[model samples]
Target: MMHLTSRYLISLASFIVLTSMAVAKTNPACLKHLGGGYGDAECYHGLSADITADNDKLYRNLRATIPLGNAHQKLLNDYMASQNDAIKYCELQRNAGAQWKAEHDGSMFPALYEQCVYNIRKTQSTFLQDLLKMANWK
Candidate 1:
């Protein structure tokens, strides 16, 4: 009985490890280093930086359009120009990360925090891209 149980456990562990390795390869920048905090954090941070850079370019393109010639147009553009949406997203991610840490402890803190930050940055980038597209609709 003991031998059978040990073999079963070993098999389960191997299956889990193999599954995670497959997941990691699916997205090298974001998932490849997962299951370990430091490597995962590093990968996610780099992914976040890439997203942020893209967002900066999107913001610049959106800003350049600067819907002009009327008070309402200026108001709308100003709201988007101020980066309030991105700020709110970052704030939300920070709060969620803090809550996750409080509940889950530190072994996975880096992975969780970086992944959350990266996700929010990606969302922010998407929003900026959409806004730029909207601006170009004119």
Candidate 2:
């Protein structure tokens, strides 16, 4: 059951990231579509998905640099484990958001949460990119 759940989550995450990736690549920039709330949310969600995909690709590239061995297999396994761990992170994010919404009680909660998540993903993507550079990968 646990394995199936992780597999499902991975598939779902892949679908989302790949789906948004196309729009994300075309824009390059998530230039805020202001006035319309839907547009701004789209910007945040799209950019977040893009950054998530970027981080995944960078880590995969880093792993690829390692020759096939026990260590390589371990890295591959760790990547899947990390994806499973992301479910826990999402739970934490929701809990924190609930607390904040309870205190503030505004329409901005959803957008603010999405923006915060985007920032976190962006940071992770940048960090992964730096790691790739340090490894001399293109």
Candidate 3:
């Protein structure tokens, strides 16, 4: 009885692990609609890194541009605003993904995923441009 129970436990654990992996690896149908694949994953990851770097550069540039009273204070305010906007954008993407999945099923899943990634990158670029402009302003 003890041996049987141990075997069952191991099997259950294995099953759970496999299920989790499948869930994680399976991209949402919307992602497919956007054209997401392994390449999309790579692109998104790289874009995320670039966004981080650009944000840092924006902060530095802002510091350089505004040497007036409490520059650091203004920087904090701007950074917080940008961060909040980014969080909101991510939430929008999550909701959009769910809606897309319900409407499209799994058809063209890769294309959808790619489009989602592209949208993210486009948003990031716009955000960075705005930040840079603010930093450059007099």
Worst 10-residue stretch by lDDT in candidate 1?
Answer: 24-33
Stretches of candidate 1 above 4 Å error? 1-33, 68-106
TM-score: the better of candidates 1 and 3: 1
- Model 3 stretches with alpha carbons more than 4 Å out: 1-34, 68-76, 79-81, 99-138
Ten-residue region with minimum lDDT total, candidate 3: 25-34
lDDT of each: 0.67, 0.65, 0.57
Error in Å for residue 133 of model 3: 5.5
Better of 1 and 3 by lDDT: 1
Q: Candidate 3 residues 25-131, lDDT tens each?
A: 33334334434455555445444555555556765665566556866757666765666465445434544656734444443443344445556555755766786
Window of ten residues with lowest summed lDDT in model 2: 100-109
Residue-wise C-alpha lDDT for candidate 2, range 19-130, written one tens digit per residue: 8865645254556344435555567767777777777788788777667785766865675466535544543554476673345543445555566667677776776677
